[model samples]
Target: MFNDISGKYDFLNHLLSFGIDKIWRNKLLGSITFASDSKVLDMATGTADVALQIAKEKGVEVTGADISDGMLDVGRVKVKTKKLEDLVQLVNGDAENIPYEKETFDIATVAFGVRNFQDLPQGLIELHRVLKADGQLRVLEFSKPKSSFVFWFFGLYFNRILPFVGKLVSKNNTAYRYLPVSVNAFPEGQDFCDYLRNAGFTEISFKPLTFGISTLYICKK
Candidate 1:
């Protein structure tokens, strides 16, 4: 599904969110407390945006993982274009069964990715397992709006207008439509914090962004 729209994913993402996704991503990056030698893992890192940005800012080794080859291919080109090959690497990997040894990474990030996990708990557990003690993990994802007016208007945009425009632009019928459904069905707030705690995360907390249109979860192992 992602492979089909990889070409348009970045553009539509910025367009659909009116570029607020970038601001949200910046918030996720700001949440990070980077070690001088932090080894970072970015799960479901479609197009490697976070991986590249972190590498550019911190000059650290970043491994970006995703299942979609089309997206990875795009990311690889960007890495090369930016001459960041030495700092960033993109690999094909699954979140639920990460291909790494225990306690290998100092930090991990998942931007708008966890809600797509086939097994959310297992994915979180894998993330915890791969992080060093005191390692930090940040997750940015869509959520329900808190304000009544925002909820009503955003619901109309999300359920109707967004998908319609997304289809016309991306020429993919199902991907955008599936997004709202997945976000709406996925757990949020304290319910999602419970999953993090179950996966052995400590100091689990989340803050809503853009009128609660999305959430950023901060956790430590």
Candidate 2:
């Protein structure tokens, strides 16, 4: 599904979010802390936007893993174009069954990808396993708006306009349609925090962004 729309994914993301996604990612970046030699794993990295952003750190190493080769191909091009090939590497992998050994990364991140996990708990556990003892995890994902007025307007835009625009741009009928369905079904807010706690994370918390249209989850192990 992702591979089918990989070419148009980045374009549609910026268009649909009105470029607010970058701000959201920056917010996640603010909460993450690591050493000069720290290694970061970006799970379900899609086109590696998060990986690319983290690679800006002077000596940070980023590994971007995703299930779709097409997305990785586009991400690799971006990395090469940015001359960040030495700091960032893209790999093909699954979220539920990551190939890395335990305690490999000082930080782990998932941007707008946790909702797509086939097994949410298993995926979270895998992320936990790959993190060092004091590793931090940050996840950025779509969430339902809290205010009634915002919820009504956002719902109209999401359920009506967003999917229409997505289909028009990507030419993939089912992919965009599945987006809202998945977000609605996903456990957001504290319900989601429970999953993080169950996955062996401590000091877990989340902050809503853009009037709750999205959320950034922070946790430590």
Candidate 3:
């Protein structure tokens, strides 16, 4: 599904969010606290945007793993263009079974990717397994709005206008439509925090971003 619209993913992300997507991502980055030598893992790293940002911080080693080759190809080009070959590496891997040794990474992140996991809890477990003791994990994902007015307006945009524009721009019929469906069906807030706890994380918490249009979850091993 993602492979089909890989080329237009980034553009549509920025366009659909009216460039707020970057601001959201930057917010996620700002909340991360790690040492320069910490190794970071970015799961479901479609297009490697999160990995690229981590590399820019300097000294940290970043590995971006994703199942979609098409998205990874574009990400690789961007990495090369940024001359971050030494700091960042892209790999073919899955969320349920990441291709890294247990306790390897000090920090792990997934941006708008957890909902796409076939087994959400298992994917969280995999993320936990790959992180060192006390390692931090963060997830950024779409969420339903809380306020009445925000919910009403955002729903119209998300369920109607956004998908239409996405389809028009990406020319992929099912991908955009599937996005809202998946998000709506997926668990959020406390439900998601439970999954993290079941996956062996501690100190779990989340904060809504942009009027609850999205959420940022933070936890530790």
Candidate 4:
């Protein structure tokens, strides 16, 4: 499903979120505290947006790993276009089995990608395995709003307008339709934080972004 929509993934993403996605990504980058020479692993890195941003902001060497070669193809083009080939690399790999040695990365990140994992716990464990001791891990994901009105509005938009527009633009009805269903079914807030703890990450904290439409989770190994 993801491979099929790779071409339109970034396009519909920016469109469906009204460009707020970029702002959110920037915020996630800002929250990251890393050394200049940090080696970062971006898992499930669709189009390498976060990985590129990390390199641009922190001058870190970034490796982006994703299961979809089609998505990595798009990300590679962007890296070339930005002249970041020296700093950023994209790999076709799964989150549940990162193709790297243990304790390799200084930082790990996933942007709106964890919910798509076939086995979330296995993916989290893999992330933990590759991260250096005391390394930082940041994750961005969709969440339900706390306010009733906002929740209702977001629900309507996601359940109705988003799927319609996503299908029209991406030409993948099932994929877009699955978006809302997945978000709705995925655990959020403290429930998700507890999952992180179970995966062996400590100092877990989450911050709601953009009126609680999404959340940024920070954890430590």
Candidate 5:
């Protein structure tokens, strides 16, 4: 399903989100309090937008891994175009089975990608395994708004307006429809944070972004 729409993924993403996705990614990057020369792994890094932002803004070496070669192809082009081939590298790998050895990265990140995992707990455990002691894991994902009124409006837009626009632009109805379904199915708030804690991460915290339309989860191993 992901592979089929990989070509239009990035384009439809920006358009459907009204470019707020970029701002959300930047905010996720800014929330990272990593030191210089940090090594970061971006799991399910479609097109490497978040990974590229981290490398450019924080001078970190980023390895972006995704299961879809089509997405990686676009990411490779962007890396070369930005002259970040030396700083950013894209690899074909699975989030639930990262290719690197244990404790290999200073930080691990995933932006709007966790819900797609076939086995969410396995993926989180893999992310925990790859982080060095005290290293952080940052995840950005969609969440339903807490406010009833806001939630109603968001649901209307997300389930109706966004999918319509996405289908018109990307010509992939199932893919856009899956977006809202996935978000609705995923756990949110303390329920999600508890998953991190159970996976052996401490100092777990989450911040609601954009009036709870999205959330950023931060945790330490």
Candidate 6:
């Protein structure tokens, strides 16, 4: 499913969000306390946007792991084009079964990716295992708005408008429709915090972004 739409993924993301996705990504970047020689593991790293951004901003090395070859192929082109090949590397791997060893990374991140995990708990645990002691995990995901009006408006756009635009642009039918279904099925806010807890994460903070159109989960291992 992902492979089929990989080419249009980045384009549709910016277009659908009206370029607000960069702000959300920046918010996640702000949560990190970058250091010299810091190693980052970006799980479910479609096209390596966060990884590439981190390397450009902090000059840190990032390993982006995802299951989609088509996505990685696009990412590699961008990496080489930007001449960030030295800092950013994308691999074919899964969140539930990461290729790296335990305690390998100083930080881990997933932007709008956790809910797509086949085994959410196992993915979280694997992320925890790869983080060094006291390492932080930053996550960005969609969430329901607290306000009734906003929730209704948000639902209307997500369930109706966004999917239409997505399919028209991406030329894939099921991919766009599946997005809202996955987001609706995902456990957000406190329920999601419980998953982090079960995965041995602490100091968790669930901060809503853009009136709860999205959320940022910051946690420590």
Q: Could you say which candidate leads in lDDT?
A: 1
What residue pairs are clashing in model 2? none
Worst 10 residues of 6 by lDDT: 40-49
Scored by CA lDDT, what does every candidate get?
0.95, 0.94, 0.93, 0.93, 0.91, 0.94
Clashes of each: 0, 0, 0, 0, 0, 0
Q: Each candidate's TM vs. the true structure?
A: 0.99, 0.98, 0.98, 0.98, 0.97, 0.99
The positional error of residue 133 in candidate 4, measured at the CA in angstroms, is: 0.7
| Model 3's TM-score against the true structure | 0.98
State candidate 4's TM-score.
Answer: 0.98
Q: How would you encode candidate 1's per-residue C-alpha lDDT over 61-177 as one tens digit per residue?
A: 999999999999989999999999999999999999999999999999999899999999999999999999999999998999989999999999999999999999989999989
lDDT of 2 by residue, 138-204 (tens): 9999999999999999999998899999999999998888999999999999999999999999999
- Model 6's lDDT to the true fold? 0.94
Each prediction's RMSD to truth = 0.7, 0.8, 0.8, 0.7, 1.0, 0.7
User: Which segments of candidate 2 are over 4 A away from where they belong?
Assistant: none
Q: Which stretches of candidate 1 lie over 4 Å from their true place?
A: none
- Candidate 5 lands at a TM-score of 0.97
The lowest-lDDT stretch of 10 consecutive residues in candidate 2 is: 52-61
